[model samples]
Target: MVTGTLDRKQERIIAGIPPVSDFSGIYFYTINNKSNHELVMLLDSIIGLNDSVLSDWLNITPRTYRNYKQNTDVVLKGNVKEHIVLLLSLYKHGVEVFGNTADFEHWLTEKNRLLDNEAPYSFLTTVSGIKFIDNRLTALEYGENV
Candidate 1:
């Protein structure tokens, strides 16, 4: 597997998240109850990565990389920021993973194993663990207020 280096800040971010992806109640447990730190732990778990791989990705020392992660917990939890960081983590390793990316729907449709017509809705909803867009959802054009 390919490994990279990270500055201290990046290392801290990866070190922050827990490594579990099977939890069905990740969001409800974190957001509704303000357990953002718990979510940070989960993001850190992605691909079982380390500071070295991340350092190379960031082109900095491990120290700086880790510091950013320690502070980026909240943004990581909201799926607003730190996504590229997360993606870079996986991408550098040649691993495929998912987040709240805008391409989520399309990616799920084409690659994610569908449970036989139970989807375009339920599957994604379940995978995302969010109930915002019910059954009647459609992909919006770019910048169309998704």
Candidate 2:
């Protein structure tokens, strides 16, 4: 449901992805695909996050990520893979709710009154935090005050 324009590569990467609400589907994808650095970088680019932020979110050092990127055979741990899947799903949902990637990125970087003046980007490191952000987006979409 991404309303924002995506490049052909991004579209192909996201093609056939299920909605975020489909936890089981995402879980299956994560388990079966066993994420590599290439996929992580693709999702990070689509979400407009830099390598530093993505490394922090994944709890991996930048050097480690670079090494992984260089070694195509290297697959991330299951937890990291799951987290990446959740992040991409959240990014898609955010774009759909905000009508475009730029607006969603702005919302993510800005401090929110509902979050006690914390930017939404601060919460991307954890799955529960991502869900909280998702709930906030849903509230806005439904015209409910959070």
Highest lDDT: give the candidate number. Answer: 2
Off by over 4 Å in 1: 1-43, 72-146
Q: What is the C-alpha lDDT profile of model 2 across 43-80, one tens digit per residue?
A: 65676667787778777887876676678677788888
Q: What TM-score goes with each of the models?
A: 0.26, 0.84
Clashing pairs in 2: none
C-alpha RMSD by candidate, in order: 13.3, 2.4
lDDT of 1 by residue, 27-121 (tens): 33333434344333433444344665444333446675466457645433344223333332322222222233334434333432333444332
The alpha-carbon lDDT assigned to residue 145 of candidate 1 equals: 27
61: Cα error in model 2, Å: 1.5
**Alpha-carbon shift of residue 91 in model 1 (angstroms):** 5.0
Which ranges of candidate 2 are over 4 A from the true structure? 1-10
